[model samples]
Target: MAEAIFWVSFAFVFYTFAGYPLLLMVWRRLARKPVKRGFWQPSVSIVIAAHNEAMHIETKIRNCLELDYPCHKLEIILSLDGSTDGTEEIARQFESAMVRVIPSLVHEGKAAALNRGVAAANNKVVVFCDARQRIHPHALRQLITNFSDSTVGAVSGELILVETESSDDDTSAPMGLYWRYEKWMRGMESDIHSTAGATGALYAIRRELFRPLPEDTILDDVLVPMRIVMERKRVIFDPRALAYDKVACCAEIEFRRKVRTLSGNYQLLVQAPELLLPWRNPIFVQFVSHKLARLLTPYFLGALFVSNCFLLRGFYLIPFALQFAWYALALAGWLAPERQQGQLASRTAMVGKSREFS
Candidate 1:
């Protein structure tokens, strides 16, 4: 019984993260259809919300200006959300006739900033980009191509982890691995239906479908695109359109980001319970495998530990031993100073910290 339970839990985790994604990929490949680019060019409003982002705001503006889109048709809107540093000042320096700057006195979160930016938008399409992320020259074009299909209400670009030129040690292995898996899963999900979520780093939606997110919202990227999905409009992933950003060099920094994201995801689940309901959403399998599984991972880990402890007195030595071995591996991963191990440790620490903080 103990062995069966162990396998069942293991299978659950595996299927949720890996098996389902693979199945989706296969399904997509079998029923794939080509999308043709139409001669339609819509005015695009590029909205960027910046808060204490002086380090990369200039680069972001330069990249946006250099994008391969019609100069007159593309408008850049930068919202400086109560930035104390030189963020607002630097952004204002780039304020030409094409770029508009919205300065706020209060430091609202990204969601509020984006809401304000979207309201100021006068284009048919709104593309949200992070101040830190650098987009490919043709990313906007690739995203606009998907708009050729009326069913596609939102389109997210592929995020590539830009290899830091300073590091020859391949210190970004864990992040690289995660991005590869994410890209694969997204491609598969796009093939069958809409992707489970979108990255705030680079995603575009029709201006008409824009909805103001709650002020306390953390994952505006996911919430915005999921809103489009709820409206029965397809949210697509375009791998050809790429945005690149350096993976966080500090594991602690990355862990904090992930914890905040997870907390926001929990909040989203509460706000949009219908999205998780199988009967309400026909593509329940994607939601369960992609989003729900991530939310339940900590609980699953706790359950596994408790079950192992409970079965220690029974005739389950082998299963208990296996559990110990698996935990030993995880511990080893935590102890090692290598990037991969550090990242694993950061995730584990986040689970513990989130529980404590909650």
Candidate 2:
């Protein structure tokens, strides 16, 4: 029974990390449905959700103003949610016919802010972006091209982590490596069918498909797109549209952010139970394999480790050693210092750090 449990958990972990992506690769090659992309600027409303984003709000506004799309057709809405940090003051500096500032008296979180921002949008297409990232001017243009296809409802722009000049720099950073792998798999998912979700940093949707999220919502990126997918429209990915930013420089900060993200995934399962049903969610398989599997992986790893302890006679010893090695490598990656300018490229490990290896 222990052996059976061990293998079962092992298979699940393997499937979560490897087998699912392999399936996507074969699936994409067989059923690649390319987005019927075309070029033309439609009227767009850029909705930026800012909560005490005083540091990045001004830069974000300027970034929106420089987009390649027509000035007359574009509107920028700064939705401020109870920012005590002068975010409202900086945002008010830009209020005009082209820029609209909507202030919320209380800090209700991003979901509420988004609801307000999307409600104020005046155009057919609403582009949602975070204040921290700098988008490529052409990214808006690239995202708009997808709207030309009537079937495409939401489009996710690529989020690129700023990396060092040395290729070996990212090998020690776990988050950086994981994000790139995730993006690659998501791209394949988009090719074969709809990607399960959009990147929160940068994405666009048809203004009419917008749904008011619960005030406590998390993972708005996934919820918004999946809802659109439920409406029987394609939620696609376009790498040509780019948003650039640095990964969290501090490991502790990144860990907390990831924890909040994981909590959001749990919240999603409760708030939107229909997403698990095939008939209700158009991308059920992808969601189960991609989002749900990942949310459950850490628990599976625990089970795999515990079950392995009961059967450590001969062949079982190999996996036990491998598990130990895996944990050790993680520790080493965390303890490893970032390489200085003149250091050798091979100084970093391979598993945890992503941006350095990017």
Candidate 3:
């Protein structure tokens, strides 16, 4: 029983990070469902949800206005969800026919802000973005091209995380390396069917397909895209549609993000139980492998470590020592958090240098 438990836990840990992606690679080769992408110039509405984003609002609005898309075909909406700061003031300065502002008197969270902004969108495609990222000039052009495929209902843009001048030169830090790996996996999943979710920093959905989110909701990025997937429409990733964001100014920021994501996963299970039912969700296999498995991986790692202690003989000893070393290194980093930022993780192949906040 000890050996059986040990191997079961070990297999899951391995499968979560390595086996699943390897499976995706082989599966796509066997049965690839490619998106029939072509040039498309649909009138687009860019929606930004914000609260106390004064530092980034002005630049974000300008970035939206300066996109390579036709000015006559585009409109920008800023959903100001009760900003007590000068965020509303700065955003209002740019209000015009091309730029619209919707202000609320109380803070309603990002999901509610997006609900309001998207509600006011009049264009065929609504491109959602955050305040901090600087989208590429042609990102809108690249995103819309995927909609030429009749089956595609949404398109997610790639997020590239560049280092600040003050940061270390090594891009192989834990956050940087892990993020690029995740995106690479998402791209593979997209080719097979639809991505598990869209990137909140930049992604476009057909306005008509839009569903208003709960005001207190979390993980709008994941919830919105998966809901679209439930409608049996394809949600694909476009690498050329780039949104560049600076790495988090602090290491603790990443930990908070992880907590939010994990919490949001639980919220999703309660809000959309159909996701777990294979008959209801068309992408159930992908959802289980990509999202649900990820949520349970850390516990699997814990189980692997705990179960290995009972079989500490011969070959089992090797894995036990490796696990010990990994945990010790993790503990050391936690004790001395300063080491988290500049430290180098093992070098590996990277897609684009990218990371995400939502």
Per-residue alpha-carbon lDDT of candidate 3 for residues 297-317, written as tens digits (9 for 90 to 100): 888787888888988899989
Best by TM-score: 3
Model 2 spans > 4 angstroms off? 163-172, 331-358
Q: Give the TM-score of candidate 3.
A: 0.92
Candidate 1: regions farther than 4 A off = 1-4, 29-36, 165-171, 302-323, 337-358
TM-scores for candidates 1 onward, in order? 0.86, 0.90, 0.92
**What does the lDDT read for residue 252 in candidate 2?**
49
Q: Give candidates' CA RMSD values in order.
A: 5.0, 6.1, 5.6
Ranking by TM-score, best first? 3, 2, 1
Candidate 3 Cα misplacement greater than 4 A, ranges: 166-172, 340-358
Which digits, one per residue and each the tens of the lDDT, describe model 1 over residues 266-318?
A: 88888778887777764567877888788886676666666667677655666
The most accurate candidate by lDDT is: 2
Per-residue C-alpha lDDT of model 2 across residues 1-358, encoded as one tens digit per residue: 9898899999999999999999999988888988888876889999999888888999999999998888999999999999887999999999999999999999999999999999999899999999999999999999999998899999999999876453334442666888889999999999987998898889999999999999999899988998999999999999999999876544544556779988988898898899999998888989999989988898989999889989888999999999989988887765666533213222232222343323
